[model samples]
Target chain A: MDKMVYNFSAGPAMLPVEVMQQAQAEFRDFNGLGVSVMELSHRGADYMAVAAQAEQDLRDLLQVPDNYKVLFLQGGGRGQFAAVALNLMGKNAKADYIVTGQWSQSAVAEAEKVGQVRVLDGFETTGNGPRALADRWDLDPTAAYVHYCPNETVEGIEYHFVPDTGEVPLIADMSSTILSRPIDVSKFGLIYAGAQKNIGPSGLAVVIVREDLLQQACPHTPAIMDYAAMAKADSMLNTPPTYAWYLAGLVFKWLKREGGLEAMGERNKAKAELLYNYVDASDFYSNNVHPQARSWMNIPFQLKDDALNDAFLKEAKAEGLLALKGHRIVGGMRASLYNAMPIEGVQALVAFMDRFAKQHG
Target chain B: MDKMVYNFSAGPAMLPVEVMQQAQAEFRDFNGLGVSVMELSHRGADYMAVAAQAEQDLRDLLQVPDNYKVLFLQGGGRGQFAAVALNLMGKNAKADYIVTGQWSQSAVAEAEKVGQVRVLDGFETTGNGPRALADRWDLDPTAAYVHYCPNETVEGIEYHFVPDTGEVPLIADMSSTILSRPIDVSKFGLIYAGAQKNIGPSGLAVVIVREDLLQQACPHTPAIMDYAAMAKADSMLNTPPTYAWYLAGLVFKWLKREGGLEAMGERNKAKAELLYNYVDASDFYSNNVHPQARSWMNIPFQLKDDALNDAFLKEAKAEGLLALKGHRIVGGMRASLYNAMPIEGVQALVAFMDRFAKQHG
Candidate 1:
C-alpha cells in the first residue's frame, strides 16, 4: 500500500484507510461473488443485501430512530436543496431559511424556484466575522419548515446549538458536518448529507426523513426527488450509485469498530483543538470565525501575510499534507478533518503550520 | 488477479477487466497524488483534467458532432425520463413516445407525470416477444420530441434502425446500447445513457444534447437536470460522481486503444452471432426476439421445459457463468454479452448449453 497522505479536502475528503483497502480487496470480487459490486444487478439478491446492510449500518452508527426512513439518493447536495422544498413545502407556499453562509444561501435560491422562501435573520458580519447561525429569530409557526446548513464548508462555521423552531419542522443541510459528531436526530424532521464529505463518496445523498413528513410533495416534483415515492421504493426507485453506497457501508462498519459517533466526536474535538490552539498561540496565523461558531470538521485559518498563502500550500503539499488550500470563494487555508481523518494527521498539520509560521515570520 | 467469471447482469453490468484492475491499483493513490480520485476536489486541476479527457475521449469515440454537448449528469435513466420532458417540452406541450418494452413504457409513464405523452404505435404483443419498435407510426410533427428506448433491457430487444421523424427532434434512451456501436449524432436531438451499463457505474447519466434544443426547460425543472445550466458548468454545476467519471475516462481510453466504436461494434456483433447461432440450432433452447430486432448486447432465451430454468441457472453458475438468470418479469435466462464480455465467454456459455441440453433433453 502507498504511504497515506493527510487529505483535507472540504468534500470528497479522506475516507478511512481501512475502507479504501477493503474496497481495493473487493474491487474484483465481492463476498465470493465473481462480479464486482458495481457489476451486480441493483435488484439482485447480492446487491440488495449490500444496500440493506449499508442503511442498517448507518442507522446503527447514528442511532437513527425507527420512524425515520433512510434513503440513499443520487443528485448530491444541490439537488436536495430543490428536493427539500419540493417534498416538504406542502399547501403552505413559504419556507423559512436561516442564511449563515454560501450553502444556506444556495438552499434558499433553489427553494425560491420551487416555492416562496423567507430568509429569516440572515447572517450579520460581526466584528470578528460572520456567525453561522443568528443569535435569535422570530419563529414562523405556519411556514413549511425551517431550513439551515449546520456547517458551511466555505464559511468554516457551524451551529453549535439546535435552533428553537417552535412547531415548524427543522430541515438541515448537514452536507459538511454529518457523521463528524453525534446529534439528536429526533429534533430535526429531515436531515440530508451529501456522501462526499464525511460519509463516503460523491454523487449521493443520504436523506433521513421522519415518516410523518413524507406527505405533500409539490405537484411538479421530479420523481427522483419525491420523498414518499423514494421511501416506498426503499431508495431503489432508480439505479443507485451502488459503489458509493457499498463504500459508505464499509466506513459505517469501520465507525462502529472505532466505537461509533461518540468516540468519533472525542477524537475530532481533540484534532480541532490541536490545530486551533496552535493557531491561537501564534501571532503569525489567525482564524476568522468566532471560536464558538468555528466548525470542528472544517477549520479555516489565514496567514497574517496573505502573500504567503500559495507558498504555504505548496510547502504543505511537499510535507504530504494535501488539499489544505481553502475553498476558492474563501481564500486562505482550510483543513477539513472529517470522520476518516485521524488525529495524527491533524498533529502533522499543526507541526507544519508551526514550522511554516516560524520560517515566514 | 482472481480468475475472471463471465457476468451476464443487464445493467450495472460488466466493466472491462483492464478498467477494474486500473481502478483497484488507484484506489489508494491516483497519479501519485497521495489521495484516491474519490478524495480529489472536483474543481481541482487534476480532477478537471480527468473529467475533460473523459468528455473528449467519448466525443472522439462516438464522433459526436460539435453542436452537441456531452453532459455528465446524476440520477440515472429514470430521472432522465422526466428531465427529457422538463427540458425539451417547449411551447408544444406534448411528446410522442414509442413504447417497446418495460424501459420505454417506463419512459412514457415518467414523462406523462411531467407533460403530455402520446404513445406512438405501442407494441400489441404479437405471437413473438414484445417487439421493441413499432413497425409503422404516425409522426407527430408538432410535438416537442419523439422519445424511444433504442434498447429494452428487460425484454432483451433493440432497434437496429433509427426512426424517421423528420424535422422533430428525436430522443433516445440508449442506456444499455451506448458505446457498443457507432451512432449518428446528427439524427437525434438528445441521447442519454445511464452509466451503469456500458459507461461506468450507476447513479450517473451521460446526456448528449444538440445545442439548439436546450431552451425552454419547465419552470419546475431541477437545476441539476437543466441542460443549459449543466452545459455551462461542464457538469460541475454540482459535485459529479468523480470516481465514476474518472473510471469512465479510463474505459474510454481503453476503447480508443482497442480501435474505438467501429471495432467495438464488430466485436459485439460477432459475440452476439456466436450465442444466437447456438441457441437457434439447439432444440432445447429458443429465443423469441426477431432476428432483425435481437440485441447485440443482451440475448434472452428460454428452455423448452420451463421446469429446468432453476436447474440450468444453478449449473451455469457452478460452471463459472454468473448472473445468467433472466429478469424476474421476463423469466428463463438472459446472457448479456456487453462490450467487456470476451468471445470466449460466449463460447463457454454455448458449450455449457449443449451439455445441459444433452443431460436433460
Candidate 2:
C-alpha cells in the first residue's frame, strides 16, 4: 500500500512535492527575514519581486505576448464571471457566450445582469465527454467579446479548438485547461484562469488581457476589476493574495524544472490516453465522452452495473484511490488526470478499474 | 540575536511558523494524499472538510451567533469598499462614514458611487496621526448605516469609542484590528477583515454579516458578492481559494491553541506598548498619533533628524528589523504588531531603537 492515497479529485488538485517543500522551508522566515512570506507586505520590495517573477514565469511558459497584461487578481473564476460582464460589457454591448457546461452557463447568467449576452453553443453531454453543439453562432457585429469556459469542472467538458472570432475579441476561461497544454496567444484578446487547478491555489485568478481591451470596462466596475487600475498598480491595487502569488511562482518554477508546458502537455496526454483507452477496451467499465472531444485532463466513467458502484468506490478507497466520486451534478466516477498525476498513477488506476470490472462482471 | 527579524507589515502579514511548516510538509501531498492543498477541489471531501472546519473554528473564535453569516469573499479590503456600498445601500439609502485614514476615505468614495454618503467626522490631524478627533461629527439621522475603519493600516490610527446612533447599524472595516483583540460582535451589524495580517493570507477576506443585512443587497449586485447568495452557499457557491482556506483553518486552530482572544489581546497590547513607550521616551524619535487613540496594532514613528533616515533603515535592516519602513504616503517607520509577533520581537526592536536613539541623538 502507498504512503498516501492517489488523489483524483479535480483542483485544488495537487502540486509538485518540491514546491511544497521549498515553501515550507521558507515558511518560518523568508531568506532569514524571520517572518513567513505571508507576513510580507504586498507592496514591499520582497513580495513585489515574487509577483513579478510569477508573471514572468507564466509568460515564458505560455509565451504570452507583450501587449497583454498578466494580472493576478483575487476572487476565483466565479469572481471573474461578474468581472467579465462588468468590465467588457459597455455601452451598446452584446457579448456572445459558449455554454460548455455549468461554469459557462453560470457565466452567461452572470453576464445577463450587465449586458445582452447571447449563447452561441455549448456541450450537451453530462460529463467529461462533450458534444459541442453550438448551432453556428450568429455573433453580434458590434458585440463586446465572446466568452467560453475552455474546460468545465462539473461536466468535465473541454474545447479542442479555439473558437474563431475573426477581428472580435476571443475570451477563454482556461481555469482547468491552462498549463495542461499550450495554445496560440495571438488568437485571443484575453484569457483568464483561476489558479487553484493548474497554477497554484484558489483566491488568485490570472488574467492575460490584450492592451487594447483595457479601456472597455463598464463604468460601474470595481477598481480591482478595472484592468487599468490593476495594471497601473501592478496588481497591487489592494493587498493581493500574496502567499498564493508566491506559491504560483513556485509552481511555475516547478513547471520550468519539468521542462515547461510542452513537456507537461505530452506527459498529460499520455496519462489521459492510458485511462481512456483502458476504459474503452472494457464493457465492464464505460466512458461516454466522445472519442474526438474527450478531455485529456479529466476522465469520467462508470461501472456497467450501478449496484456495484458502492463496492467499486469502497474497494478503490481501500486501495488508496481518493476523490474518484464524480460530481454530484453527474453521478459516477471521475478521474481527473491533471499534470501532477503521473502516468504511473494512471497505470495504477487502469489496473484497478479492470480488476474491479472483472469481479463485477 | 534572534534567528529571524520581526515583520510588521500590516495585511498579508506574518503567520505562525508551525502553519507554514505544515503547509510545506504537505505542500506536494497533504497527509500523503499525493496532492497539494492548492490543487484539491474545494468541493472535495478533503478540502470540504477543511472549509467546514476553518469556518467552524472562526465561528467559535468570534463566538459568531447562528444568525450571523461568516463569508470568505475575495477582492481585498478594497473589494469590500465597493461591495459594502452595493449591498447595504438599498433603495433610498444613504450611508455615513467616519474617515480616519486612507482606507476609510476609500470606503467613503466607494459608498458615494452607490448612494448619498456622508463623512460624519475625520479623526485626522492634518492628514497624519493615529487618533480619531471625536469632537467633530455630523452623523445623519436618516442614514441607513454608519461606516468606519476601526484600524487604519498606513496612518496607525484606531477608534477607541463605538458611536451610539440610536438604531443605525454600524459597519466597520476591521481589516487590521480583527483577531488582534476581542470585540463585541453584536455591536456591529457588519464587520469585514482581510486575511493578510494577523489572520492567514491575502486572498480570503472574512466577512461577518448579520442576517438582517444579508438580504439588502442591490439588484445589480453579482451573485458572488451578493451576501444572501454567499451566506446560503456557505462561502462555497463558487470555487473557493482552497489552500488558503485550509491554511486559514490551521491558523484558526493555532489561535485557539495559543489561547483565545483574551490571551492574544494581552500579548498584542504588551508588544504594542513596548515599542510605543520606547519611542515616546526617546528624544530622537517620536510618534505623531494621539496618545490615547493610538492603534495597538500599528506603531509609526519618525526620527528627529530626517538626514539619518536612510542610514537608520540600513542599520535596522542589518540588525534584522525588516519592513520597518512606513508607507509612501507617510514617511518614516511603521511597525505592525499582529498576533504572530512575539513580545521578544517587540523587545528586540525597542532595545535596538533605544540603542540607536542614544548613539544617533
Candidate 3:
C-alpha cells in the first residue's frame, strides 16, 4: 500500500479515504452503467437519480425545513458573491454587510458592484487584537438582507454564535465551516458553500435558500445565477458538474455512515482541541485568533522564531504531513481539518509540530 | 478487464479509455504527491504548473494565436450565453444570431436579456427541407457580433463553411464539435465550447477569444465572467474547475498523440460518411439533416416504423451500445462519434443497426 499523507490545504481540502476508494472503484463503471459517472448524461435517468439522491441526503443530513430549496449550483463561492447580490438585492437595492476578515471583506467588494452596501461592522482592531463580534454593529433594519462569512479561512476566525436578525433575511457564506458542525438550519435565510471545502470538488456550489426569497431576484440576473430559474429547473438550467456532484453525493453518504453531523461535530471538536490545546501550551508556537472565535475547521499558528516557518513546513512535509503552510496573507502554518480529516491525522500533525519546535528551539 | 461499452452521450460524452485509466491511476496520488490533484492548492507551484501546461497544450493543439486568450471558465455553456452578451456588447448594444436549433435559440434568448438581439436567420423549412445557409440572410453590418452554432447537437446540423462576416466579429458555439476537426483560428472573434462534449467534463467551458474583443466587455460584467479579468489572471482570477482542467489537459495530449486536429478531422469525416452512407442506402432508415450539413460528431437517424424505437434503444443498451436514444426534442436515434469513439464502436453500431433492421423489417 502507498504511504498515505495527511493533507491540510484549505478548500479543495481532504475528502474521506473511503470516498476516494469507492470513487476509484467506480471510476470506470458506476453501478453497472458500463460507463464512468463522468460520462453519464446529465439528463438521463442514471445521473438524475444521482443528482436527486445527493440533494435529498444533504437535506436529511441538515434536517432542512420544508420551505427551503437545496440547489446544486456552479460558479463557486466567488460567482455566488455576485449572484447573492443580484438575486437578493432586488427592488430594495440595499444590503447590510458585517466585515469580519478576508472573505467577508471580499464579499463586500463584489456586492458593492450591484447595490448600496452598508458595512454594519468593519474589521476593527482593539489594543489587544482584532475586535470582538460583541463590538457595536450599526445594522440597517430596512436593508434587503444581512450578509457575513460564518468562517474566515485565512484569518482563522469563526462565529461561535449566530447573530440575531429577526425579520430581515440573514445570508451566510459558509464555505469553510459547513458540515463541520450541526447548526439550526432555520436560523439563516440562505447558506451557500463552495463544495471544494467541506463538500466535494471545485466547480460545484451548494445553496440552501428559503423559497420566498427566490422571487426577489433581479430581472437582469443571469439565468444560471437566478435562484428562481434554477429552483424551477431543479438546478438543471444547464448541464451541471456531474462528476463533482457524484463525488459530493458519495461524501454525503460517507457522512451519514459516520453518524451524520452531530457525530461529525464531536469528532471535529476533539480534533481541533487536540491541536489547539497543544499549541496553547507551547511557548514556541501560538495562534492569535480569540479562543472563543477560533475555527474548529482551520487552525493557523505562528512559531516564536518566524524564520523557522519554512523549515517547519519542510520537516512536516517530510513526515508525510502536507499542505500545512499558512495562507500567504497570514504567514506561518494553517492546518485545515475538514470533515474528511480524521483524529489520527490531527494527532500526527500535533506530534510533528512538537518534534519540529523542540529541534528548532 | 472490465467490459468497455460504447457511450453515445451527446455531452458529458465518451472519453478515451487510456485517459480514464490514467486518471484512475493518479486518483490516490499525482506525481508522487500524497494528495490527489483535486486536493491540491490551486495557487501552489505544482498545480500552477498543471494549469500553465494545460493552457500551453491546448494552444499548441489548436494553434491559438498570441492575440487570442484561452479561458478555462466555470458555469458551462449556459453561463457563457449571458457572459458573451455582457462582455461583447458595447455601445452598439446589438448583435445578430443565426438560430439553427435549440442551442442557438437559447443563446439568442439569453443575449436578448442583456441587449438587442437581431435574428439574422431562423430554422425555416421549405417544401424541400430546411433552408440552406447560402439562402438570403438579413446581415447586420453594424452589429457587435454575429453568433451561430457551428454544429447543433439536437438538430444534428453543422456548418460546412464559415460565414462571411466582414468586420463584425463572428462568435460560434462549438459545444458539440470542438477538437473534432481543424479550422482557421483567425476567422472568428470567439469560439466557446462546453467541455463535456468533445473536451472534458460538464462544469468547464473553454473560451478562445481574440485580444481586441477583450476590451469591449461591459462595465457591469461579473468579474468571473469578464474576459479581460480572466485573461489577466490566467483563468485563475478565482479557483478554477481544476480537476476538469487537468482532465482536459490529458485530452489535449491524447489528441496530439492521435495526430492533432488534422488527423482527427480526417478520421471523423470517414466515420461520419460510413454511418450517413449506410443510412441513406437503407430503405428502412432516414436522416432529415441535409447530407452536406450533417454533423461529423452527432448523426441522428430515424426508422421508417417509429414503433420500433423503444425496441431499438432497449436492444442497443443490451449490446453495450448505450445512450443511443435520440434527444426527446428530436426523437429517433443519435450516434455521437466524438474523437474518443473508435471506428470499431461505429462498426459495432452499424452492424447492430443492420441486424435490428433485418429482424424488424
**lDDT (CA) per prediction:** 0.88, 0.81, 0.89
Give per-residue CA lDDT, model 1, range A1-361, as digits (tens): 2564898998788899999989988898898887789999988899999999999999988889999999999999999999999999999678899988899998888899878888875454454333333545776789999999988889788877788787899999999878888988999999999999888999889999999999888877888899999999999888889999999999999999999889999999899888889989999999877777788988888999889999999999888998888887888889998888998899889888889888999
* Residue range with the least summed lDDT across 10 consecutive positions in model 1 chain B: B124-133
* Model 3 chain B poorest 10 in a row by lDDT: B125-134
TM-score of chain B of each: 0.96, 0.95, 0.97
Candidate 2 docking DockQ: 0.63
Per-residue lDDT of B327 in model 2 = 87
Positional deviation of A17 in candidate 3, in angstroms?
Answer: 0.4
Give the least accurate 10-residue stretch of model 3 chain A, judged by summed lDDT: A122-131
Q: What is the lDDT of residue B211 in candidate 3?
A: 93
Instruction: Report the poorest 10 consecutive residues by lDDT, candidate 1 chain A.
Output: A124-133
Question: Which ranges of candidate 3 are over 4 A from the true structure?
Answer: A122-135, B122-135
Report model 3's TM-score to 2 decimal places: 0.97
**Per-residue lDDT of B280 in model 2:** 78
Clashes of each: 0, 15, 0
Question: Model 2: what TM-score?
Answer: 0.95
Model 1 clashing residue pairs (backbone): none
lDDT of 2 by residue, A1-361 (tens): 2465577867667666677778877777677666777777777788778889999999999999889888999887878888888877767768998887788998888889888888876665544333345435666768888898887877666778787777778888988899987888879888888887788767889998889887877777777777878888898888888888898999999999999889998998889888878888888878776665678887888888778878988899888787788887778889888777777778888889888877778
Model 1: residues with Cα > 4 Å off, grouped in runs: A1-4, A125-135, B1-3, B122-135
lDDT of 3 by residue, B1-361 (tens): 3665899999889999889999999997889997788998898888999989999998998899999999999999989999999999888789999998899999988899789998866464333333454457778889999999989999898887888888999999999878999978899999999999888988999999999998887766777898999999999888899999999999998999999999999999999999998999999889988666788989999999989999999999988999988988999999999999999899899999999999998
